[model samples]
Target chain A: MNRVNIVGIIVLIAIAIASPIIAGSFFAPPPAFIGPEFLVQIVAWGLIIGCIYVLLASGLNLIFGVMKVVNFSHGEFMILGGYVSYWVSILVGLDPYLSIFVSMVVIGLVGVLTERVCFRRVLGTSKLNEIILSLGLIYVLQNAMAISWTDKPIQIRSPFEFVTVSFGVVRMGLDWLIVIGVTVLIMAGFYILIKRTEVGRAMRATSQNRSAAMLMGINVERMDMFSFGLGTALAATAGTLLAILAPITPQAGAIPALKAFTIIVLGGLGSTIGAVVGGLVYGLVENSTIVLLGATWKDAIAFAILILVLIIRPTGLFGEKEA
Target chain B: MNILSDLRKGLKTPKIYLPILLLLVCLLIPLFGISPYFIHVLAVTFFYISYSSSWNLLAYSGQASFGHAAFLGIGGYVTTIFTIQTSIPWLGLLLGALVSAFAGILVGLTCVRLREWFLALVTLGFSIIMVALTIELHWLTGGVYGLAVPSLLPSVNHYYYGMLALTVFLVFIIYLITKSKIGLAFVAIRENESEAKATGIDVTKYKLLAFTMSAFFAGLIGAFYAHFISYINYQIFHLDYSFWPIIISVIGGIATIEGPIIGSSLMFCIIEFLRVIRPLVETIDPVIKLNYPKIQVLLMGIILVVVVIKMPKGISPWLRKYLISISK
Candidate 1:
C-alpha cells in the first residue's frame, strides 16, 4: 500500500522471475534465443513449490499466533490431502485438478470438526499437553492413511500430459503451467480473504487478543475453527501441488513438513508475508544447496542455516517482535 | 503422636515400593528359562526407561528438547572411542555422561533464551544438524556403517545385570531430584515462567540445571546402550531416536518418575508387538506383499492420538486410577 511496500513487492516479483533465468544461465543453459516455453518450465516449478510453502506456512502462522499451538501434524495433513486427491481422482475419473478442490473442502471440514471436537477442549491446557495431543493427532492421521492406502508410492499422471506449448526456442509442460496459474489464483484469493473479509478481520482480532475479541463479541471459538479450516484447506491445496510435483507415499510429508517448520521459523511466526518470503528463500536455498552440494549435504546446509537463524534471530526474517 | 499425619503423607506420595517390588520380580526374571530374545528386549526396555526418565528431567521444566539423541550419540561414541582405547570401562561411562552434560550446558547457553515452541524448533534443528555432522565427519562417527564398541560385560546376563544396576541408579537420582526443592522450582517454571521469574526464581539457571542433569543421565543410558549392543551407528543418534524419548515422556506423563518407567516399557513392547505382525502376515501369505514397518509407524501415530484423546493425563494417571479403583 505504501511506497516501501510496493517497492518490496516489486523486488520480490523481480527476484522470483530472475532466479530461474540466472539458474539457467549458470547450469541449465538454453540456446541464445531463450524462448517463452523454457522460461515457463523453470519458473512454473519454482512458483509451484513456493506456493506450497506459502499455503503450509500461512496456516501454520495463523495456528501458532492464535492458538499458540505448533501443529507438528501439519505435514501429515498435507499428505492426507494428496491421498484424498488420489482417492477422488480414482473414484470419479475426473481431472486431478478437480480432485484438488474436493480434497481442500474435505480437509477444511475435517479441520473445523477437529478444532471443535478436540482442540477447543485443550485450549487452556499446558503447552506440553498441547504438543503431545497434536503429536497424537499426527500419529492417528498417518496410520489412518496407511490403512486406507498402502504404504507403497502411488503416482497420478497430470491430465495436462497431452498438452504442450512450444515457444520456438523451448518447450514447456502444460500441467506445470496450470499448477502455477492455479497456485497464483489460490494465493491471491487467500491474501484477499485474509486482508479484506470480515472473517479475516475476526481472525486477525483473535490472533492479536482472544479475550479482547471475545469481549467484543467476535465468537473466538468460531474464529479458531475458521482459521483451522482455512489452514487445512491451504495445506490440502499444497498437497494437491505435491501430488502433481512428486509421487505420493505415506511418509511423503515427513521431510517436507520438517523443511516447512524451518521456513516458518526463518520467515517469522504468524506472518503471512513472512511465510511467502520464507518459503521462496527456503525453496531457493534447498534448490541451490542441491545444485551446489550433493544431496547428502543439502539437509545439513538447510538445518545449519535454520539453527544459525534461530540463534541469531529467533523471531524470523519477517515476524514482528512481540511487544 | 503424629501417626495419622504421617500415614496421610505416605498415602499422598507415589507408591515407589510397588515398582521396587516389580524390580525384584524383574531381577528374578533371568531365573526362569526365558528366551535370550526376551532378555534382550528387557535390557533394551531398561535402557530406554533410563533414557526417557532423563528426558523427563528436562521436559519437567516445560522445555521439550529435540536434540536429546545427540547426548546419546555422545555417550555411545565416547564409550566406543574410550572402551577400545582404554581398559577402564567405568571411567569411560562416567566421562561420557560428563561430556554430554557439558554439551547440554553449551546448547542451553545458546538456545535457552527462546521459550516454548521456538526452543523445541531450535533443539530439533540442532539434532538434525548433529546427525548430519556425525555422517559428514565419518572419521569420528564411522558414517552410516557405524562402529562397534568394546563390551565390558562378557555375557548377555552380565550385560542385563549392568543395565539393571544403571537403571536403578539413574531412577534413584531422578527420584531425588524430583523430590527436592529444585523439582518444585521446575514445576513452578513450567506452570508460569514470567510469574516464576517475578517470584525471584532464577528461571534460566533452573532450566540449565535440568538440562545438564537430563543430559548426564541420557548420556549414561546411551553409553550403556552402546555397550549392550557393542555397536553405535549413525542411525542410533538420529533425529528419529531423539524424538522418541520425548514422546515416551509425554505419553507416560510429564514431571513424574513412574511415567517414563511405564511409558518406555509399554512403548518398547508395542513397537516389538507391531514388528511381530510383519512375520505373521508373511506366514499368512508369502505372495502378499506387506510394508509392515510403515504400518508399524502408522500404528504408532494412531496410538499417540488415542492416548492423547483418551488418556491426556498419561499412562501413570490411568494406572493410578485403576490401582486405586481395585483397592477400593
Candidate 2:
C-alpha cells in the first residue's frame, strides 16, 4: 500500500483502538450500553454532519470537475435551500423530508440562473476573476437571504422526531436515520447519473476536455450549467436535512461552506472519492475536537488540518498532480 | 541612477499634482465646519482605503488572501492585550503591526508554494483558526465578550486627520514600491510565474516580502481602527473585514494604487449614505422600510456583481476612460 493509504489506515485503526481508552475522558462512560451515551452520541452527530459534508463536497467536486471554477458561494445555495424547504414545510405543510425536493427544484433553478448569469460571463477568465466574481455572488445571495429571513434561526420539525434507534451504545433519532438514508440515496443516484447514463458520459467528457467534448457533439456550456445546477441541488438537499436536524439561520451556511472548502482541499480538488473521505475525516475531527478540546476550537481545527494537508500534500489526497 | 531618474520623472508628471490638490481640499473640508459625524464618515473612508490597499498590494504581488482579517484581528488583539499590560498605546500599535507581520511570514512560508485557490483557502482557514484560538484563550483576549481597547485618538477631528495622514503615508509607500524594481518583480511573477522565474527572480522571497508587507499594513490598520472605535473582539476577524478590502479593491480596481482609494471612498460613501438615509428609504414602502438594512447591504452586493461583470478591472479604469475621452 502507498504511504498515504497506510497512514490513513493506521489513523482509522488508532481511533478504533483508542475509543475504549478515550472513554474515560467522557462525562459519563456507559457501564452498559443503554439509552444513549454522550460519547457515542457525539460521534453519531459527527457522522451525520459528515454525511452532509459528503453531499456538499460531491456537489462542489462535480461542479469543479466540469466548470473548473471554484464557487465560493456554494454554501449560500444550501442556506437558500433550507429556507425554501422551510417555506415549503410551513406554506405547503409538506414534511421536511419531502420538502427536500421542493428546495432542490427551487435552488436548482437559482443555481442554473447563477451559472448562466454570473459564471458564464467570466468563464475562461483568470482564476482571480472567477474567485472575485463568486465573492460578489456570495454577497448578493447572503444579503438577499438576510432580507427575506431577517437572520432568525428556524428549524423544520421532522415527523419522526420521537422515534429512536439504538446501535450498541449509539442511539439516534429516526430523523437522523432518514438524513443518512437520503444522503446515501442521493449519492447513489448521483453515482448512477455520472457512471451509467449518456448525460453523465457527456458530463465526464466535458470535464475531461472541453474542446474534445465539443468535438464529440457535447454542448460544453450546457454541461457546465447542468453540473452547476446539480451541484447546487445536492447542496440544497444537505441544507434541508441540516435544517431539520438543527436550527438554521441565514448566515449559518457560511461556516459549513468554508469547512467544505477545507474538505475539498483535503480530498484534493475535483476528486469525488477524496471529498467523501475528506468530509468524513473532517467531520469526525471537528466533533472530536469539540469534545477533546473545547467547543471554541472545533471550527479552527478543520482549518489547521487544511493548512497541514496543503503543506504536506499540496495536490491533496486524491487530486491529480498539478498541470 | 535608475532611482534618481525615476524620481525626477515621477515629480514632473501632472498626475502627481492631482493627489496634492485633492489632499489640500480634504485637509480644508473639516475647516468648513462640516458635522463631526460627517468627518467620522470620511475617516471611515480613509480607514478602508488603507485596508483595501493592503489587500491590493498582496493581489498585485500575485497572492490573494481571503483570510487577511486574521492579520487584522491579530493586530487588534495583540495591541489591545499589550496596551492593557503596559499602557503604551503607540508601542501597542507598533507591536500589533509587527506581530502580525511576523505571523504573516510564518503563514507565507506554508502557503508560498500553493496556487490561487489553495492560497485563498489556506489564508481563509488561517483567519477562521485565529478566531477559534482567540476564543479558546479568552482569559487574556476576553473571548467572545471582547475587551475594550484604549481609543488612540482623542476626538473625531483628530481621528479624521490621523487616518487621512496614515492613508496618505501608506498609499505613498505602496505607490513608491510599485514604481520600483521590486514592484516589477511582483508584476512579472503575477503575469507569468515561470517566465518570471526564468528571468531570475526569486519567487519565494518576493512572495514572502509581499506577504510580510501586506500583513504589516493590514495589522496596523486593524489596530488603529480598533483603537479608533475603542473595542476589540474575535468578531473583528470575521469575513466582512476580509471581504471589504476585496470588494473595494475589485470595485475600485485591483492591482492599481488609485483603485482601492477610489473604490473605498466610493463604496463607503454609498454605504454611509444609504445608512444615513435608510430611514427616509424606509418611508418609501412597507417592504422597503422593513428590509432597509438588508437592502443597503444587498445593494453593495449588486454593485459588486455589476462591477465584476460590466467592469472587471473596476470603477477606476472605467472612470479614467470616461474622463480621458471627455478631455480629448
Candidate 3:
C-alpha cells in the first residue's frame, strides 16, 4: 500500500526465491547449484510445467473469454481425457500421442454434453451457481472415474522412455521435447483458429458481446456450447500430455486445474502472450519453491502470489481493465 | 434488545412453526431409539447446515468463499490446541471464533476490493496455507496425523442435540442480522456495489461485517466438527470441506435460511443411507465387497447434477411454492 510496503514485499520475495541457491551452495558438498547442467534442468522442468499450465489455463480462459463462465471442472475434463487415452493406448497399442485425438474428440463431445445438461442452466444466473455446479461436476466425474478404473495412477509407458535429447548442457527426455512441441502446436493452432477463421471470428464476437453477436446473426448459445467443447478439448490435450509425461490418476486434476486459474489471473484474461508468460512464471516459481522449500509449499506459494497480485494490481500484469 | 424483540415478533407467523416442529422432531428422534450411527450422521449434517448457512450469509454480501475450510481448520486447530493447553473447551471455542473473525476481516479487506473470483482463489489459497502451517508447526499442532480433540458432550445423544441447538441458534442470529439495517446494507452492496456506494451505505463496512460474521460461525461449527469427530488433523483443510458447504448451499438454494437446513439434511440422508447400506451388502455375499462409498458418492453427484438441471433455483423455492399452493 505504501512505498515501503511495496519495496519490503519485493525484498521478501527475492529472499524466498533466492534462498534455495544459497542453502544449496553452503550446506551441500556437490556444488550443483551454480552448475549450468543444474540450471538447464531447472529451466527444462520449468518450461515443461509452464507449458502444461499454459495449455490448461488457455482452455479455461477460452471459456472464460467467450461465456464469462468459469468451469472449475476443466481439469477433470483433462483427467477424463487422460484416462480415455490411457485405456485406448493399452487396448489398441496406440501411443498416447496418437490417442490424444481420440481423447480430444471424445472429451469435446463430453464437454458439449456437460454444457448442455448442467452449466447451460446456471450459466448466467450468478457466479456462485456456476462455481457450485462445477464443483459438483468434479465430485461426480472424479469419483466416477475412480470407481470405474480404480484410484490408482495410470501410466502409458512412453515410446521414448529411455531416450534423451541433448543440447550441450541440456539433456532432457525426448518425451518432454514432444510434450512441449505438441503444446506449442496446440497454441499455434488455437491462435490461427481464433484470429484467422470464420468460426473463430464468431467466437470473438460472442466473447465481445453476446447480444451484439446475436444481432450480427451469430447463434450465441451454439457458440457457448462450441467454445465449451473446444476449451475442454484443449484441457483434454493437456491431460494427455501430462499422462505421457507422468503417471496420472483420477485425483490428479484438482491442484493443476487450480494453478491454471492462478495462471490465467496472473497472465491476465484474453491475452495469449499473457497466459503463456504467466504460466511459465508460475511453473518456474513453483519449481524454485519446491527446491527452496519443501514440496508442500508449491500450491501455497502460488496462491500467496495470486493473493498478493490481486491485492496490489487486480487487473494483473498484461490485463486491460474490464468494461 | 430491539433485534431480540424483532426475532420474537417473527415467531407469530405460521411459517415459523415449521422449523419449530422440525426442531422438536429432531429433539425427540434420539428418545425414539435411533442408532448412534444415525445420530452421528445427523450431528454431521448439523455442521454442514451451519457451514452452508455461513456460506450463504457471505454470499448475500456478494462474496463467495471457495476455501471456507481455511476458517474451519483454523477453528478446529486453534480450539483443539487451546482446549488441550488450557483445559477449557468453551474458552477454546470462543477464542477460535474470535481468531477466525479476525482472519475474515483481513481476507475481506484484501478481497472485497477485487473481483469475486479472487476471493474464491484467496480463500482456497488460505486453506492450503493453513494445511502447510499445521504440518510445519507439527510439534504444537500434531501435524498431518492430527491431534486427538476432546469432546465436550458426553455421548452421541448429547452431541446431536447440542449440535442441533447450536446450529439453530447460529442460524437465528444470522437471520436476525439479515433482518437488521446491517443486513439491508449487505443486500444493497450485493445487488449493486456502486449503487450502494452512491446511496451512502458504507459498502466496504457492510461487506466486511458480513464476512466477519460468516467467518465467526464457520469457525465455531468447525470447532464443533473437530469435537464431533473426536479428532483434529490437516485433512480438515481438504477441498472437500470447502466444497461441501458450497454444494450444500446450492442444493438448498443459496442465500436462503431454510435452503441450507433442508439441503444438508436431504443430502446427508441420501449419502449416508447408501453408505450405511454398504456393509449390509458386503455381509450378504463376502465376495462382493462393492466400493459403495465411491459408488454412493457418484450417485449423489448424478443426483446433484439432475437437481441442478431440474431445480436450478434449488429445492427450497419449490417447497415454498408447494406450501403456498396447498394453503390456497
| Total backbone collisions for each predicted model | 2, 0, 0
Native contact share for candidate 3 = 0.61
Tens-digit per-residue lDDT, B78-104, candidate 3 = 899999988886788888888989999
TM-score of chain A of each: 0.84, 0.89, 0.89
**What are the candidates' interface root-mean-square deviations?**
3.0, 1.3, 2.1
Model 1: how far residue B259 lies from native, Å:
0.6
Each candidate's DockQ score against the native complex? 0.39, 0.73, 0.54
> Best DockQ goes to which candidate?
2
Please give the lDDT score at residue A1 for candidate 3: 35
Return the candidate ranking by lDDT, descending: 2, 3, 1
Best model per lDDT: 2
Better TM-score candidate (2, 3)? 2
> What tens-digit string does per-residue lDDT give for candidate 1 at B246-302?
677767877788888888877777878766765666677533345456556666666
TM-score of each: 0.86, 0.94, 0.92
DockQ (0 to 1) for model 3: 0.54
lDDT, candidate 3, at A2 = 46
